[model samples]
Target: MALIDFSFYSSIYSYNHLFLTVLSFLVSALIFLASMRKSKLKRVNLPPGPAGWPIVGNLFQFARSGKPFFKYVEDLRPIYGPIFTLKMGTRTMVILSDAKLVHEALIERGSIFSTRPRENPTRNIFSCNKFTVNAAVYGPVWRSLRRNLVQNMLSSSRIKEFQHVRDKAMDTLINRLKAEAKANDGVVWVLKNARFAVFCILLAMCFGIDMDDETNEKMDQVMKLVLITLDPRIDDYLPILSPFFSKQRKRALEVRKEQIDFMVPFFEKRRKMLQNPESDKTAISFSYLDTLFDLKVEGRKSGPSNEELVSLCSEFINGGTDTTATGIEWGVAQLITNPHVQAKLYDEIKQTVGDRAVAEKDIDRMPYLRAVVKELLRKHPPTYFSLTHAVSEPTTLAGYDIPTDVNVEIYLQAIGEDPKLWRNPEKFNPERFISGGEDADITGVKGVKMMPFGVGRRICPGLGMGTVHIQLMLARMVQEFEWSAYPPNSKIDLTEKLEFTVVMKNSLKAMVKPRA
Candidate 1:
């Protein structure tokens, strides 16, 4: 009886052990399969781009290519199509050249793609930690600053109030050009006088004070120094390499100090005027500084600091000056190069304004003048690329997975010249705009055929003001003088060199004779 009981217990124990072993193996296999599936799901499908060496990425290749960064990317378009990736140090940049893809990302997914990438340390120092409208992150601070600018200063009514300022500046510009032409044998440097004129207008609007030529020149020089400091540095892309760029960093800080010292007195002057009610009321016109003083940013307990004020003023002045001046220069160059276009434009101006100065209101009446400005901007955008944009969240652009931490840039020139979008894209034709292309929205709201001032929510708030400046100046220039290429029959060189804006490699030099 005992032997039979032992045999039964032993068989039961063996059966239980076998069942537990099989259950453990099944669980392990299932976990392994699940992990494999998860790994596959996490794999990102990034855009096609030239492969680079580990760590340093395409930095060496780009440096070795001996081409401007934009041109380098332009060359790659044939290889990788419109959208492609470039790895610069630890940073990943996605370049979009296709209008459809640009519209899709910057418009359809604007909320996700409108934010700015983290600025470099140097830029942050100047921007007061991204407090200015152009540099601020996409949030309450940006909304508050941008709203303040648009409503208070750039509004249509407000712009109309500044007409006298523009008129005075125009007079100064025409006088300066005529004097220079007289002194230099009917030859004048277009950009130099154009920039000074625009600067005068902006300086008055910014500080509510009209400075003499000497002071204006000094301020211009200081602003130029500030812009030089703002240029991109090697350390900006690779922070780990920052220690080597101590000299550059030191110079940037020094320039920042100089900027603050130069601008603070104007702030104090404005403050005093605001405080003393008995001060000359005529001398006190509403200025951007006035608005900044009263501004209440969303998250801040107090108004912008003096440092922040300097940065904001810099942004406002720098934003309008080089861009507007560059546009004027390019427009004049195009007029000189294509005399037929100039003649047509001049005839339109003559019919509209008729021997009088081109007023702001007259700009609205001339359609061909508008077309000429559009074509100039299309061919020579102020900047090669729009302000750097970033994704608010990880998203897919077209078929490619765009990570949240990458810089997104739209090649403005490439889109403007896209063969698929414009017929005979290489030719300088304003007539296209008068007909089918007249509907071409520079705002890129309806659809993006060309985006000179950028598009979507982050589009340049100064778009209206900027266009007005360009059109009015171009009209006045053409109506007041007969412009021809310098040195008699020499061709106006259209070769571009990138600066704060894409400026002509050889600044436009023209011979001017006053119109009858």
Candidate 2:
């Protein structure tokens, strides 16, 4: 009787256990199906792009393309039809090559496309936790910083105030080039001189003092090292592989420390000077550093911290220097390559300002020179894609569903070279601005014929200063000297290398004779 009773209970227990197990499986299946359906619903109408592999997405193809990322994107435009998407690891990057779409998305719906990517280890450290105006996500901090910079340092009134700085720097540059022309048999590599002059100009504006060659060289090293740290790595795409790049990241941190060490002393010195007014010292007329010292951000007990100040000052100097120097490089390269253009430009400069140094005030009368600079920018933008933009929220762009936080790369280089827009687009023709019936507004307002400085709300704050520097430097070079390809019969190689800025693969070596 006992055995029979035990068997009956065991059978009942087995039946109950089986029923619960089946019920659990069914519930789990239902949940998974619901989730998949929800995911499908969420991923509606994403832009058409190269079909990607799971997990890796199109990253392998992108790497295998044997081209710069921007060029690769441009190549895809013909097939993908202007606007297309690429998945890099888990991240979605949308490329906007169509001017209409770029205008529609970045200008019309700017509020959505304005913010930066979420803070990551790489960018956070690079920006001192997004204290910089350029990398900072669009928000109160960014606005405050930008307003302070624009009003104090970069505004038209402010830029005009800093005219003396640019003039002095230009004079020094011309003098140095003259020396080089004499020493190098009328052949000079103008890059060093160009870089030095722009650095000095930006340094004075940034730090309220002129740095000596040694100091300037040291700062240049620091900037180059810092820029080297910014090169994209595999870990940037594959976060799971980040540990392998720990050494690289560590080196970047060390470089940042060195940069801060070099920059922070200026901030402290300025602070001390402000505090002690009676000290025997020449007061700086005005400087971005001085303005930053006085900046008052809401909810902050003090102005920007020294680290933040260092970051901003670094950005001010480095951003303007390399980009402007590159412009001069490319402009000079084109002048060397297209001697007819050079002759026309020299004639214009000579007519505009006879035997006088080209000054900021003189830039306006030289329209041909202005057109040359615009053409240089169109042909060889220092930055292929303007600093990357990220989506603030999920939205449709050009009738495609763009999800929140995806990367958006606007192809400025491609836009400039689009055959549909410009006649003989590949040719370095400055006269296009003069007679081509299309506008040459670099500011991207009258439509983006060329956006070397980018467009919309996030347009480079340094655009005004950069344009002035490039024009003055180029004009002065033309006015004061005759430049030609070094070692006659050699072509000025326009081969490009993607550096911190797109630079001449070979440094511009040219023969320059000082004009009587």
Which regions of candidate 2 fall more than 4 Å away from where they truly are?
1-41, 277-283
lDDT for model 1 comes to 0.81
Candidate 1's error at 375, in angstroms?
Answer: 1.0
**Tens digit per residue, CA lDDT, model 1, 347-448:** 999998787788999888999999898888888778778877888889998789999889888888788888888898888899988875445788787789
In order, what lDDT does every prediction score? 0.81, 0.75
Model 1 scores a TM of 0.90
lDDT of 1 at 29: 50
Off by over 4 Å in 1: 1-43, 277-284, 436-438
Residue pairs with clashing backbones, model 1:
none
User: Cα RMSD (Å) between model 1 and the true structure?
Assistant: 17.4
Residue range 388-449, candidate 2, lDDT tens digits: 78777778887888877788877776788888888989999999889877566676676766
